[model samples]
Target: MNLSCGIIGKPFSGKSTLFALMTGEDGGGKFGPVRGMAKVSDSRIDYLSSLYHPKKTTYASVEFIDVPGVSGSETGENKMLEHVRNTESLLAVIGAFEEEDCDASLQGEIQGILDELLLNDLILTENRLEKIKHQRNPQEKDEFVLFSRLHEALEENRPLRSLDLKEDEQKAIKGFQFFTLKPLMFVINIHEEAIPRAEAIENRLREKLANDAHTGVIALSALIEEEIMQLPEEERPAFLEEMGIGEPATEKVIRSIYSLLGLISFFTAGEDEVKAWTIRKGASARSAAGEIHSDIERGFIKAELVHYDDFAATPDMKKLKEAGLVRLEGKEYVVRDGDIINFKFNV
Candidate 1:
C-alpha cells in the first residue's frame, strides 16, 4: 500500500526539517512544501537480497508531505486542511522544546489549527444532517436516524470515530468526509535534551485523553533527527550510542505510525524483487494482491507463502517445501506479518 502521511505544525515546529530527514529530499530551505518517498527499510528484504543477490529489490515506501509552517501571524487557510485530508494519516508536529520564556501564542496557534479541523468537521456534519432531515420519504427514516445520531455526537465535541456508532451508522457517515474522524498521530518535536522526557509527555497525554482512540501522541526530536540523518549510515549506531538515543526518530515515527494505524507488513522476496507490502492487520490474500496489481487481485487463485526466517535459514524454496514451512493459502486467508508470499494469480 502507498500509505502517505502529512506533517502539519506551527512555524518552527520542524515539520519541514522532519520531512527532509524522513524523505532525504532537499527543498533548498525549510520553507515551502516538500514531498518524497522513503524506503521502509526491512531487514528481511536485506537478508533476502543478500541471499539471492538479484538484479533488483523493491523496498516499500511511505510518502511524506511537509506543509509550510503555520503560526499565529499567518492566516488559517483551508488549503493545509485539504492537504491533510488527502493522506492516509496525519502527523501533527507540536513544538515542545525548552525555552526561557515560552511564547504565549504558541498554544493559541495550535488551537487555531485544531479549530479549523473542528470547523471543517462541523460543516460536513451539519450538511449531512440537513440532507437527511430534508429527505421527504418515510422509507429512508432509518437512514436519517443514523445521520441524526452522528450529528449529535459531532456537535458535542466528539469525533465520529470516537463514538460507538453502529456498523450501519458508520456506513451512513461514509460519504461525509469528516476531518476530525481520521486517525491522527501527534509528534511532539522537541530539542535534543528533551528526548529523555519524550515518554513522559506521551504518558501525560494518555492520562489526559483517556477516551480518545482516534488520536495518539509521541515525542520526537527533529533537530536530533536532522543531525542523525546527515551522518553516515555506518557511524549512526556509535553516534546514537554516544548520545544514548535508542533509535533514529524516523524509525520511531514509522513504527509508531504502524501501531497507531493498525498496519502490518508481508514480504515478497527474491533478487528480482525483495519487497515489503503494507496492509491493514486483517487484510485478505486478494486485497494484498490488489495492492501489487488490480489484475492480480482479479485473477488471484492462491498465495504460496513462507516465513522470512525460514527462508533465511534454509536459503532455498525447495528446502522450505521439504521442511513443510511453505504453505498455500486461499483468497480468504488473512495476510500475516513477515509472511513471504508468492501470489498465484492467473492474470
Candidate 2:
C-alpha cells in the first residue's frame, strides 16, 4: 500500500510551506487541501536512474496532504478532525520560531492539541464500551476487555499504542480509528539560528514520550526547507552541507515514516519501466503481486528474482543468470528489499 502522511499545525505555522517542499509544488493558498505525491528520495532510485537514464525515471512516492490546523475543539470551522481521522500517519508541525524576544510556548500548544486528540479517543472508546455493555451475550468479550484497558490508558493521558492488545483485540478497535492511536512524526519548527539545537529538542520530546511506539520527533527550520526548495536543484546539496544539514527535512521525515510503518521497497526493472513498489516487510510474493495487479495475484506463478546488491555488482542480468544469482520463488516466498522481480503468470 502507498504510504500517506497528513501535515497539520497551527495557522501560519509553515505547514503549507512544508507540504510545498515535500511535493515540489506551490501549494500556498488560503482554504483547501493541497494533495500530491512525493518521491521517497531513496538513494537506490538515484543509482538506478543514473545507470539506466530511462525516458521517465520514477521513484516510489508517498502522498502528502495539507489539512487545516487543529483548533483544539471537536467542532470547528476547519475540518481538521475529519482529516486527522482519515490519515494513516501524522506530521504535527509545532512552530517555535521568532525574531524578537517573544516566548514561543510550544509545549502548551502541543499539550492542548494532544489533549484534544486524547479526548477524541476517550469519547469514541466510551461510546464503543457502552455499546459492548448493552449486549447481554457478546460475540467477542475480548474486545470489551481490551477496550476497557484502552479506556483506562486514555484516561491516564496515554494512547492505545501504549497498551499491549492482542492481534484480534487490536483489529476490533481498528474501526474506531482513534487519532491519538496513529503513528506520529512531530516536527519542531525551530528558528534559523537554533537549527543546530534540534538534537536537544528531539531528546526532550523523546524523554517525555518514551513509552509511545513508532513515534519520532525531529527538529527542523521550515524557513530552511523553504529556502532550499527555491534554490536550483544542483545547488541544494552544497547549500545544505554548508548549513550543517544532511538532507532536506522532507527526506528525513519520510524515511523515518517508512521505517516506522514497516514498509519496504522491491523493484521491477526493464526497458519498459524501472519502478519501485512499496510493500510490507515479510510480505509474500503473491501478496506483493496483488499490489501491482489483483489479476496477477489471483493467477499465481513463480517469480524470477535477483537481489539488487548482486545485480549492481554484476551490472548485467544475463551475467547474474549465468552466475546462478537469479532464483525463482513460489507464491509463499517472502519478498526482500532491493529484490528485482519479474512475475510469470497465466491469467
Candidate 3:
C-alpha cells in the first residue's frame, strides 16, 4: 500500500508531461526527481461517504517519483539507477507520436529500454560473479554456482525478472536488486489521432508486454491530457463525455499501477470518518489491521465484515443486522476489494 513507483524514460520522451498529468501538477523546473502523492480514485469511497455523511473522508494514495531522463552519461545513468532502485515499480514513458521520420516506434522504444535494463543487470552480475569465482572458500563456491547460472540467463538476453527462484534462492540475491527484476508498467504516449488504435496497439504488444505477471501496457496521449487539464473544472466532465473517455490519464495510470502491483482497497465508514485503505490482494485480516495501527493488530480478536454490495443494499446498520449480512471473520480471512470491515480489538 505504501508502494512508490519511479517514472523513467529517455530524453525527449513525454515522461515529464505524463508525470504532470498524473500528479495534477506542473513538472517543477528543477534538476532532481519530482515527487507527488496521487489519489487512488474509488467510487466506493464516494458511496460510503454519501451514506455515512462522515465528518472527514479520505482516499488511498500512492507516491510517484519522476526520475530525470537517463542517456549518454554514465553518471546520469547511475543517478537514475539509484532512484529506480528505491521504487517498488517502474513506469517507462515512450514517445510514440508519428513524425516525418517516425524513428521512435513504440515497439522499438520498449525494446531499447529493456536492452538497457538487461545490460545494467548483466554488468553487475558479471562483476559479482567474478569476485565470487576468485575466492577459493567452499561458501563462496556455492554463490559462484548460483550467480553463474544467472550469468547464463543474462547472456541469453533473458532478464532476471523471468526467473522463478525458490524462496531460499530469492533470499540469496535479493540484496542485489537487479534493475531487470523490478515490475514494469509501460506508457506509450501516442499521438492524439492514434487514440482509437490504443486497444489494437496493446493487443499487438501483448506478448512482449507480458514481461511478467506484474507487467502491463497502456497507450495514452499526453497532448490530450494536457489540453483537458487546461479546461475549467466544471467543463471537463462534459469534454471527457464528448470524447468518450471513461477515465483521465491520471486515473488510468493509477488503475494500471494498482493492477500491476496487485493492490486492493477496503473501506471503513462511519459518522466520524469514511476511509479507504489499501492492501495487497491476498492480505489477511490481521495484516490489514496492522496497516491501520500496531495496537489494533496486536489485540486483534475478530473482524466485523460485510461486502460493500450488501451494505449498499441495506445501508443502515440496523437493516444489515436484520438481514444477517454482516459476519464476524477471524484473522485468517483474506480481505477483498470493496469489503467493509471493523476490527474488534481491546488494547
Best-matching candidate per lDDT: 3
Could you tell me every candidate's TM-score relative to the true structure? 0.86, 0.89, 0.90
Writing each residue's lDDT as its tens digit, candidate 1 over 178-246 gives 667667777777778767767776676655446767677777888887788879999999988887788
What are the runs in model 3 whose C-alpha is more than 4 Å off? 28-30, 72-75, 99-104, 134-145
Q: How many backbone clashes does every candidate have?
A: 1, 0, 0
Off by over 4 Å in 2: 26-32, 71-79, 99-110, 140-142
Candidate 3: tens digits of C-alpha lDDT, residues 225-304: 88888999899999888766666866888878877777899988889999999898899999999999999999999999
Error of 1 at 133 (Å): 2.5
Measured by TM-score, how close is model 3 to the native structure?
0.90
Candidates, ranked, TM-score? 3, 2, 1
Which runs in model 1 stand beyond 4 Å of their true positions?
Answer: 26-33, 72-74, 99-116, 137-143, 164-172
lDDT of 2 by residue, 27-79 (tens): 54456666878888777767777777766667877788887664454356236
Residue 74's lDDT within candidate 1 is 67
